[model samples]
Target chain A: MTPELPTPRVTVDADVLERNLQAMATRAAARGLALRPHAKTHKCLEIARRQVELGAAGLTVATIGEAEVFAGGGLDDLFLAYPIWPSPQRAARLRALAGRVALRVGVDSVASAEALGRAVPGLEVLVEVDSGHHRSGVQPRSAGEVAVAADRAGLRVRGVFTFPGHAYGPGRQRPAATEEAAALTEAADAVTAAGLDAGVRSGGSTPTATFTGVAAAPGAQGAPTSPGTPTSPGALTEMRPGVYVFGDAQQLELGTCDWTEVALTVASTVVSRSGPKVILDAGSKVLGADHQSWTTGFGRLLDHPDARITALSEHHATVLFPDGAPVPSLGEVLRVVPNHVCATVNLADELLVLSEGTQVDRWPVAARGANT
Target chain B: MTPELPTPRVTVDADVLERNLQAMATRAAARGLALRPHAKTHKCLEIARRQVELGAAGLTVATIGEAEVFAGGGLDDLFLAYPIWPSPQRAARLRALAGRVALRVGVDSVASAEALGRAVPGLEVLVEVDSGHHRSGVQPRSAGEVAVAADRAGLRVRGVFTFPGHAYGPGRQRPAATEEAAALTEAADAVTAAGLDAGVRSGGSTPTATFTGVAAAPGAQGAPTSPGTPTSPGALTEMRPGVYVFGDAQQLELGTCDWTEVALTVASTVVSRSGPKVILDAGSKVLGADHQSWTTGFGRLLDHPDARITALSEHHATVLFPDGAPVPSLGEVLRVVPNHVCATVNLADELLVLSEGTQVDRWPVAARGANT
Candidate 1:
């Protein structure tokens, strides 16, 4: 359902969002994993508060800037999930944030750990291991080396973590999660061998959240087999799924979520029509230009499933309808599901919180443009 | 040159920006076309003021929200260059804006024209015609029908305009420019045949700005070729070119601009390294994800020419260096040129305006996220 608000508006169905959150929380509880949902997706404090109320152990953030936002909003526990190369100024901010909250940062190398130790000593750090996503993190075999360096530098080496980012591709979630479990096990063992806690083995993307627990259970791996409880000193204890709160086209296409569970969509109006081509005002600037190599189009029409967004400009999305399919008239509103909801939310000023197909509140994306 | 500011910060080289702006103004003036540079590129009030000082005829914006932002910033002339599908609320806003400034809106359909006519009397309208970009606008031959309908609805039919967006691809600039001229001429004739002014035949994109003038001059078509003078009531009188203010990787790869003139770049820090892959803090959230099919990669490193952005996540850009090339060390700052500068600017709250090598000022991207 579309709202009567401005076109290209980012709208969140609170009803659907509630279901999605509850479903994810329930799934994580059943899988014996502590859920620390990523704050980068919604960037709204209202959602973060709801997530906290739903029994989320804490929140996961990507940057010191994001951590500052959440911590300022009274989020007591935060995880900066990145190989954060903090500058002097940022380290000062990190020290300030650590004083206010239960803070933990990701460290992938000895240099990074040493820098953090020098700047923000006594800070807790999770050694990042490369779990098939070569974008960041060190090799699993070198986890202890980094952990020892972190501990020696006066930083508290907590545990090891990995991001199964390769699971984002179609039909790759199973393999990626399997690799994640194996790698996290090896890295955690190395950290334990280094005489550190190695407790918080954090890993999970939206696509691999389900498989993360399934692959890491007692019989599944070294992880425990309990539901609703995670006891870990050397296993995958936490899962961070950002887009699960607002299901997007990527998740829907990847079978990570269903259309009925999608809580977010861009409410756009048809601005131009040329025969079978319907132009929507919601484009890259609003819905985001995130076309994964495997996606059907730039985005998808939530209402008209058969229509494909053939092209996208800064202010226009050219949608094509199948022959004999009804075309949306000019000024007709359409809901567009973004290929990547996180990218879409980052471009918005606020998200219209809707309940029962009516706008009930306006949640400011307070952390928007906090890209320090 | 990079600035010592926050990582993932959008920085504008004032010196390079000045050169680029002056060059485009000179080129437009020499081609005898009114330069109404699209404000969607920079979105900074300071830059819009600079364009006005440089004798820009006016500013072109994509949405009424953007128009309101510029107008509120003391700009009086604005063209909402889209098939504006105004709701009752937006129509009132448009009426208010039309009363305050010299405003013109694009209308490509009879229904939209009638809506505008009913809601905003005497609003000047430009009928949009398709010029090979099948995304929006009507067929050039049917421009008269839309114009006549607009006239019958009591809206002022100003002229016809088209966007040769096909020029964005490689080796298509010439053909796109030629087609733009022919389409504008035919559409202008059709508008004239419908007893309208047909004065503002506006057309131009970053890639086709130069060719637009070259292909439409008197000997080339119906346009006159007097440098720094545009006499128009029937030809391609105005060219609205965005992205010329900030040279991007797309413009660089398309040979539309030289690397030396690139003004805006994201100042990022190398945060993680895995063998040959170095990850930067600036990812799609900072630089924007606008990868044209013909481009080399997501973006380019301004200083390290051999490095390419291999993959982009919300908070990380995986960069790869050529064999034997030095990889950026942890915390080492780098400048990344975005693939689409407009998309990048919209993601930031402010632009670090730099002169020489230091940040002289910070200009707010006032119209950022104004995508309504």
Candidate 2:
């Protein structure tokens, strides 16, 4: 029998997690791409270990604090996937981390590359290119400038990386993956043309990870990336998709995965039922307040698909059930899938592992507050 | 000498914080209302101690986990202001907390009242009334039924509480405060008519707290609650506002506080400057992704008020400066004021207290992950 846990807790279905891990690992392996699952999604050392056990090359993090947490936990190979500004405090931490692990950081500007090089000379760095996100990365053609700056500053320029963040919207995965590959190829040429070896070409998001290489199938090993495109692989050497292991409402609504594949959910109890509105104890504090424009609500009820979270307070999620449907009784436990899994995981300190409706284990979110 | 801190760090201006605390305390004292600052805003025991030293009645929390953390830190008077569904696990914790401190809980349903009464008989419970937010609290007229049930179950039904959440928007504070007063008066009458002592009529929000009584001035004290209405005080006995201490974008937009009064900000470094767009190290992970419709952007730059954070990834904030204006130089330090102070504080594990640009002290967010 599984031990009863508290409400408003993040729970991971053990079977679903295993299947997701194996599926992503197998797909990346079949395409001959290194799988470096982004630890920013789960922030759990146990899940990172599972990913490594499934043949992941390394782990990707967004902050130096995350890298430190994962590295301190004995996971050596790490890549910080953001253009980190090497302040004096972070520089010392990065130098310490680089001394201990195979560390590679992302750089998008000459200023940042020089600062990082000054902070830790001979540090391995990757030039970040903008596929379409237009958030942080430089242009594909401009990658050479940053790489040359890093090389001139005695920092080893390893490769180019791009985040196809625009692929997050509905029905944008296939084209975004194609765009990512083309951008990586262009950036790699730029880096190599500047007398720097672009050893790695890294790019992938959760939505586009399923179509990373041209031959990746929906659920199999071989299929065309698009309807008319042939299986001509490009320069992306690795895939870094974080949210695949724990499918969220965004992925579910985007049709990236089925509801059964949603491994993570917030277990909440119905605290108040007023007419058609049922309030759950789980709110933004537990599920995270990441409401995308395309998201129908803050989150969706796992058991009752028709129930939509109309509003969220700090500690109360007001869900409105469809008319004439049987409302959930007060104190009835319900599972809620949040809009974004990474933000939700960041809000939690640990994840409750559930096996067949029973508590199997607990996984601490090791880097939960590693926001530096 | 000021020690270098990491970028995207939560820093509090000591002078601004002291002013905010003293102003709120003075206002509450002048109005003869108990000021129980919501601990969910800061979560730092040092800040809570400052509020208590300034004559706060106690503290208000959102969860039992927070209550437990505060109780362990030697804060005796605490209130959990949400309709908590007492599970066996939480029930045990609440029982322990009740035994250690003066505990008060919010109740809105018969089932929760009965369960709470059984779990900890004779515990103090306040009936939650929905003023206007339409979120968790019960209807103004239905407080008697729940109060009667609590009485029958041997629980002490003391007074009522309403969160004037509608006052959060622009130009709605005074009207919403009036609405809150009417609702609290109606609910208090119901509870008193049910043979329960309605000793506490608590109603508040950050925006409406300044207008709690009808005599609050537009920018001072002694103004009517609404247009053409006389300055007649209603049934609200006390006020609970969390965000007045650390003003946010929403508060600034609503004219509740000026930019100079904003006490907290995230210290970020400008890592990338691409034409008109500037990228900062602070993103949603540190500042929180709580964007209200009325806010200008994800956050605003404290130094350069014209700059707007147009986009936010997990680890980067893309700020857009006004065209023709001198942009921030690369590696320049900037302070970002987030949209929601409560959510922002919840995301941080600690706050750096700065006085005259010098790091004076550090305060741990003692209940950062107390979300159970």
Candidate 3:
């Protein structure tokens, strides 16, 4: 007799994903802004296509590898949304990709702009503005200098973009979004001051998307506006929000989305039961060890929300149930929502897509282990 | 002209790996224990073959996917060290695998033991004992009941095995090893009491391998015993230590190995730089976000040991260096040792083998993303 495959593999809720896409689309439409969500979160062509079909004008990617995966899969409009210093090898890939799609690469330094312009000949570039995430991008005031360098190198200057990543901590979303809008507006103005069109003034994280100006005023006369509200309608023309497609623990903590919107989960089986603890087959390798200090545990148990996965090894996740909840028995299956869905998806080859608890399709996480 | 593929994707220092392997082999040999090091850490057939040539009697695997890869590579003696509850699909695979090699499977419950016996007739089974890791494994006292079930179901009973996983964290190596011995001894006694010859009493983690009975007291003596000492002589017939083959950040933190012994490092390029911060191309996706609260950062930078990687996203690791350190320029490559090597390796498809700073071969991490 043969044994069945062990459970607790990565799964995507198609219905939930559709709902997230529709919600983002509705929000973008109300603001009269173009939605070009970042694909770095899902890295799946299918999801990218879904976003596009649901009113996303294009897709934002973080690497050439990701751009290639999406481009090969028929995504024609893409933005490599990082201030990437393209070496010759990467530049050539970028050049080829530019010819095949409406590719917009990011630049933060004069040398990078010049190098990309020389390598690609007719590449479109975006000046990356630092919207307080402080990881990358130039200061909002420096956007003009970078844009002028791109213009001198004969590259097409599009607009400016910033990631309000600082908005993702425990209770920093609201203020971070406001800061993000101000920074993006200043950066866009800098681009225009440099005699550039600044066609796309884009900036928004999942945590800040709701605050992107459109959500500032409710439809009814006395109704309260949603939390994140961008200052003005024309402040930014585009929004790039990833992670909304596959909500995880971080989104839950940041209040970016509610539990009903979380589309991705790891289906694991209870394999061992010790005193006050039940171990699942899904461990750090499967669920990923991305516990933020404030996160309740390694991950949250979907079947029993009160249970906390206290420990994780290579192939085992030990869940500790609260006093009142019943412990899961051996062979019982449970879904685990990871602290970070992006990292978890990167750790698997494929995901089982489910709709209404039935297996729908198996979509390959195209760029699953493409670390380099 | 076609550009060359990127160099230094994953650099493995052969000298360091060999040194670590030799040290563990020497320590295990002086104690009279057979080294059957776990291959789940590296998942490379080259490393597995090297361990066998270095006197490793057999190999330990965590999943059937891993076992299949090694078995296909001609590794004849193998042990699926995980307490897998044999489902029909797995049982068939196990039975087919057993026909090709000396296969031993692990079980922690009478139901699973009986299932394994019925599914794969004539298979050898080891009762898994919980040795304080509290993740998986049955109680040491329950070994007899499980063994009896295996016997009644016509399966051959091997001794017992336990993983002192608690030894992985900081400052717990020694105590965890002691508990491992105690648990294994108790399980072994239970097996004998159940009318089974518990032939192999295995225990030892990479961190606690030195503290096992075999390597314990004899080190202080000037005259070393010929092969095995009276107190430590094959106290446990076999030893299974995985990460010893590729020392990582966890090894350094646990004091099981030194930084100089770290063989594996993710080589990434600097992609973004800001005031007092630099972002590497590899982030949690490549280096893994497996840092415990005690861990300093997402990973440690090899070039600048004092630099701390303060934050990480999917594709970017933000490192902060003190005022006086030499800052890396954009496109300059750097090596990072992940806090948890196992999770990092599982995120890549292949390992770029390097010897003396020169590229040698690229070996596939065959079971790289085999989360299920």
Candidate 4:
């Protein structure tokens, strides 16, 4: 009998993914906060369902297309985590989605809040707060003005949320998490002072999740320990951790997770071996070109941890081993841990879930190309 | 009167694309070489047709799936420019494809050559040559051996091809191109000395296409000259320049083309503007996470060149502008030049082409997800 042909595939260690989900859930549970894992990482219904089963209070989505897919998959409470602008076309879709699920949309500006209120009469809006990332969100001082605008537009303004994205870099997570809590807490106080019910103060990144307590530690003066720590479990009602679902090179670099916890990898074959380089069928297209300067290469070869994929083309990856390692022979399959697991999954149509190294099932990357 | 909704888009400057095609064709024609532009970049039938019209002898594809698409589009002569080990399933497809078009497949090993020969009799094979990129291809000294194996298996050995992928990095292109020409010339000599018709001595990348000259120049003995130069017109038979069709951020970074030459961009909206960061609706999901460290951000904004997209999530690009520049208003549309144009195109289902900034036609990215 002939050997089977190697398929262009993404393999997920189901047990690892499950453990990661449980770990994050436990972290959030211990703090009495809601765990709303962002579905943008995996984009697989099975993973989303597993996250929900692991005690995710709600699902966070980055796009309406993603929200639609998760909602269609029976996830009733959805948060479109993006500050969606109300286009008439998207507004109709959001209205339809609102009818089916407990929908909460994100907003960072008075204009967006007004537009949302005009487009969907009874929409629940969350005032986005700028944590240390400084990406998208209102300043804590300006959160009240945006919340007041939302109130005037007849939209119910919920509490605040921030992404401690700055925690992603080296040695920045702890300080960033500290700043994140302070930013959300300040924003929540502003909203409450303005006579609005600041029901939720949400923030958490995978790298900062563990440092949430550091922000809550008290000083001897009977005052708050540090603004980074949450004094009350109800201070921030929710935590959103996406990449924890599939630990990637970024997560490893940030020391958020270990190699054993990396649940996703691309299965590729050594198609050619010449000189100091071994070429694999998986290239930038399959493994994804998401390398940072600190990353060893585009990805790490699981079979040889020290081997670095020095370069990648559309369909070929050039890997270099630390001198004297046995070169991979032609047709030998190898697993590559992508620099960014999220980008890698976006390239695949389906993901093969494995339990104890045995193929369990295949799940479509439902929102794989839903860019719009 | 209601204005027409803007379609999700990526435009091809037909004139620019044609000029690039003609330029490469003229270079190959002058070198007495055949021109086979790689089709993996655009992956559009229309662009492939234009390439053929501009005198490309055939087309180069990265996958059998891509080859099938072009073959079905009436392209009779093609080269699957990948070192694919032909399994029975792919072999059957190759045989079926052979019946439709003149197919040239790449092989880097004696084993793969034999497998191809056994899978599809009379298949035309090209011994892949490693010209210093170290991505794929066999060593120059091993070319004859692989050719002999292919011949022994009753396969027709066509010549050799190497991608000077190393030319992509900073200050490495000129040296890499010199090595590329030397490697290909050496491989061609080896093949001919082995009593085989090395009909094609093919190797060229967009960066090194100019450095592949036979004539000597001041301070540059045996240094490759631009393929665009008139002095070395008959040096190589075929040239594969794919990204030239749709100039990307990489092209700009390499100084290969100017920003004005960029033909494709993702149309996105300013969904949020809070604090110092402005969020765009298009993120890694649309623009793709193909950033090289040197790249300013995930992508360059067409209208706001000074604004750097500091961060990108799956559905959000967080852009930061310098202190004085006008922040993009909420709901404002923006065009983004992605770092890797090919990857971005692959992430979309369809592309809306514009003529003079007015939407004219829409083309499906036919081979969008053909990673296999």
Question: Highest DockQ, which number?
Answer: 1
Q: Per-residue alpha-carbon lDDT of model 1 for B105-215, expressed as tens digits?
A: 999888888888888889999999989988788888889999988888889988888999999898888778878888888888888887878888989898997687677
- Can you give the lDDT of residue B93 in candidate 1? 88
Per-residue alpha-carbon lDDT of model 4 for B34-150, expressed as tens digits? Answer: 778888888888878878887888899998888989899999999998888776677888999999999998988888888888889999988898887666788888899999999
Candidate 2, after superposition: displacement of residue A69 in Å?
A: 1.6
Error of 3 at B38 (Å): 1.4
lDDT-best of 3 and 4:
3
How close to the true structure is residue B9 of candidate 3, measured as C-alpha lDDT? 62
What's the CA error at residue A199 for candidate 1, in Å?
Answer: 1.1
lDDT of 3 by residue, B98-211 (tens): 999999988888877777788888999888988897767888889989899989998899989988888877778767776777678778888999899688988777888768
lDDT for each residue of candidate 3 in A245-329, tens digit (9 for 90 to 100): 9898878877887889889999887777766788788877877778777677787866676788788877888789887677877
Instruction: List residue ranges in candidate 3 displaced over 4 A.
Output: A1-5, A214-230, B1-4, B214-234
Task: Provide all candidates' interface root-mean-square deviations.
Answer: 1.2, 1.4, 2.2, 2.2
On a 0 to 1 DockQ scale, where is model 3? 0.56
TM-score of 3: 0.92
lDDT of 2 by residue, B1-372 (tens): 667777788999999999999999999898888899899999989988889999999999999989989998888999899888888888888889989999999999888899888988888999999989888888989999999998888889888998988897888998899888878888888898988988899988899977786533442354335653323364667889999899988888889989999999998988888999998988888888888777888988888888889988778899999989899888889999998888888898889998988888999999997877
The per-candidate count of clashes, in order, stands at: 1, 2, 16, 21
CAPRI category for model 4: medium
Q: Write the per-residue lDDT of candidate 4 for residues A161-271, one digit (tens) a residue.
A: 888888878888878877887788789989999999788787887888877634544542367555544444345788888889888877777788888889998888777
Off by over 4 Å in 1: A1-3, A216-235, B1-4, B216-234
Model 3 local distance difference test score: 0.81
Model 2 chain B: weakest 10-residue lDDT segment is B215-224
- Which candidate, 1 or 3, has the higher lDDT? 1
